[model samples]
Target chain A: MMRGKYVIAGIGHTAFGSLPGRSTISLNVEAVRNALADAGVEKDIVDAVLVKYPTSHFESIYGQKVAEALGLTPRINCVVDQAGASNIGMIGYAAMAIEHGQCEVALVSFADNPKTGSRAVFSRSRDPNAVFGWFGVPAGYAMVARRHMGEYGTTHAQLGAVAVACRRHGAQNLRAQLKKALTIEEYLEQPMMVAPFRRDDCCLVSDGGAAVVVMSRERARQLKVRAPVPILGFGQGHTAWDVAQRPDMTTTMAKASAATAFKMAGLLPKDIDVAQIYDCFTITALMTLEDYGFCKKGEGGHFVEGGGIEFGGRLPMNTAGGLLSETGMPGLQLVLEGVRQMRGEAVLQVPHARTSIVSNQGGVMHTHATLILGQP
Target chain B: MTDDEKAAALRPPADPLGDQFWQSLKEGRLTFQRCKHCGNAWLPVRSECPRCLEADWAWENASGAARLISWVVYHRAFHEAFADRVPYTVAVVELTEGPRMTSNIIGAGDPEALKIDQALRLVIEPDFGLFVPRFTPV
Candidate 1:
């Protein structure tokens, strides 16, 4: 278990929609500058920077270029590439860095322009699986949803519950990509991207950036930071690199990740006051809820029904609208929203939220990271 | 088939480890490698046996019998290369010999008509110029 010694001293997010004028670097710079302002800490004190690995890079110079651009020259700086799990994964790594005395204050950030630039984020390894008719994330997820349907009777309407909730949440956020509220009728009526996967059931592609400043509780106290959201614990796990080889289509690594995070934090699923589960797809969010032990296995489709995940529900989830309604910049935005919830600053604030959890699923549902955050 | 389809049908990316498997498929046989030391069989041709980490293995031809695990009918094309083939079917099937792989399941008139665990047989079809191993309900 951690000593609860690290805090997200500040968090920042830029408008999460299409803006062709912004490059990845410029967007990240804005996020970091805003984070510095929020933390009331000078940029020079930032001894490390952790960012999501750039898939757009033809070479592996991703970490070097971003660190140099941010002027976060330090002995410790690197890219965290657990995919969607990278955001929370990086937070855990930053905490470990502080514990190890590597650096005092670390800037964790991510920025992408997939909508305006080339959407080359999918597989490029050209593995046997890729060439063997793998049709990208949507197709892979559709297959998963179909299997879940056969095994657990998960229905499209149940998945629609997640979509409707995220849309409602997004409507409250000025920075969300798709702010229009969604109805179950509209969700079911949307054209199919693939069987069991309608267009509205998937997250939108957008350009945006988000940042969080992490430092040891000791450092935050020394700097006299305001409302530091201490990271109680975090855990990460992976099922497979090749999506085709996953042992179970309905289960993800989120199960193991959540187990470890909760154990380390001395908390339970019932202890979380709010959750910002990643919502790359409605089915994904449903599966994550099940895997995270919020509900029984194969019961996620039901757990989300009847406004279960909507605001004012027993367990309000994805309060920022998630990737489904939020900007599709990736998973760090979930961490940002969780931090805001802890600080009582979220746009869709969960009343008196004291403890929060953030979950990120990455790759073709390959990796998972779960974090438990709370007010110090 | 178009040039792109022909190229798409070609044995997946050139690799010594996968060459034998693709070659066997092109020769009208669906073969998966089995560990020479352990007897663990796997698909998509890996370099070493996951069971024993043994690099020594041999390609063994299958009985061409399989069962459908899951499938998807794409109504939207994520890649331009597959755009012309919209609404095409892709399925994951476990060979009776114990290796699962991805391929098109032809002869199922309606994609929705296919059922999980349904019996399927191998069908080697020419795409563009490359030979691709597909499946049909038995």
Candidate 2:
């Protein structure tokens, strides 16, 4: 619909929960097939495929494995390995490829089965150094929360508010993992994975897949389907890979990516209609809220306290429920949800949603990617 | 056991991804994966080049020297494993080779003393049975 910009023609997502019988290939194929059908585009039209997943711990070589399953083997493809930010980066790459004529149609898909006997925690084999030999992501993020509390006086109550806001949003999402409303007292009372981080503060690990079909601006028009949402801008940044090297555990690298995306889109934090920030943990959103320039630094704790992320807040975020409450399809689920919001087809649709920013943080306290999408 | 043996015990077991890296650390050398095609090196080695998609690369050793790019100090331990190491400092050291690495900052009395761009040298300590590379003020 828009000239000189790539757009998302269709999206497909698998049910976000545990499925024992479904293999990773089955999940991916289902999502890709449905996305192509929804876009009314045939599989032959897909010029490239960008598949993303954290496969270091998993044995499958993501790109080749998924390509073969899709029956599009040997097609131009690259496995993005930026961790949770993988899908968002793939989205940006697909858009740029479509814009540059390198690929006319690209399908980006991500899926992970983190709930099983799978090593959702740090890989003892991949990363042996440091203190996290046996620790998992919860412990890593808990360390971050502890540092935030020590420096900025962030409280567990404030932390619980993040879970509460996410739960409130999740209540509206049929696909969310935990939909029950949570109060501060109840949240604090939940079992502690680590001190200061309750079980509710951590995200649920489930199995699911998300797929998006991107095409050239011209192709979108030729299809004569629903008007597509355009990719306005995107950016990626990182502070350090490990938790120990992070400058301020509270100052997320999302700030760098957000600033770049805003400048590229010729917009600011004030112009966006909605946000789908990665909330692998409740504290992640708090740090992202401050880093994205939505609120001043250190005020993230307070900003989220009054249910600001709920409907009619300063900015409605994670409307489709986030990884915090939504299915743990990693953060790619958030991107799909962001596109749904921009299209005004969201279940918990924000009124008059025009522009949206989706962000995902990959790895431990490193690798941030942001994409700004809009309909203009 | 002697201090040398104790330090050696901290090193990780010989695995495909960490064998060479651990060996270099035992020699007080900081090693990383450098893509032959893209010339971009990365820590936490990958099977192939993230930029060029080339699997042809080698483990290039370094002088165990760098500058502190940035860092953070954690006064509270989030993970049960890091409980005793509260008030520890983590840093991003810019290697002489064009990449940065995430490692712990040791041999410092206070975490607040770390500075940006401070000269640092590698300190490979034995953690359990794995040899982990850390950085200390040079």
Clash numbers, per candidate: 1, 11
What DockQ do you compute for every candidate structure?
Answer: 0.57, 0.10
**What do the candidate models score in CA lDDT, each in turn?**
0.83, 0.75
With candidate 2 superimposed using the best TM-score fit, by how many Å does residue A359's alpha carbon deviate from the native?
A: 0.6
RMSD in angstroms, candidate 1?
1.9
TM-score of chain A of 1: 0.96
Candidate 1, what DockQ? 0.57
Lowest summed-lDDT stretch of 10 residues in model 2 chain B?
B3-12
CAPRI tier of model 2: incorrect
**The candidate that achieves the highest DockQ relative to the unseen native structure:** 1
The top-ranked prediction according to TM-score is 1
lDDT of 2 by residue, B53-73 (tens): 999888888777888765556
Measured against the true chain A, the candidates' chain A TM-scores are 0.96, 0.93
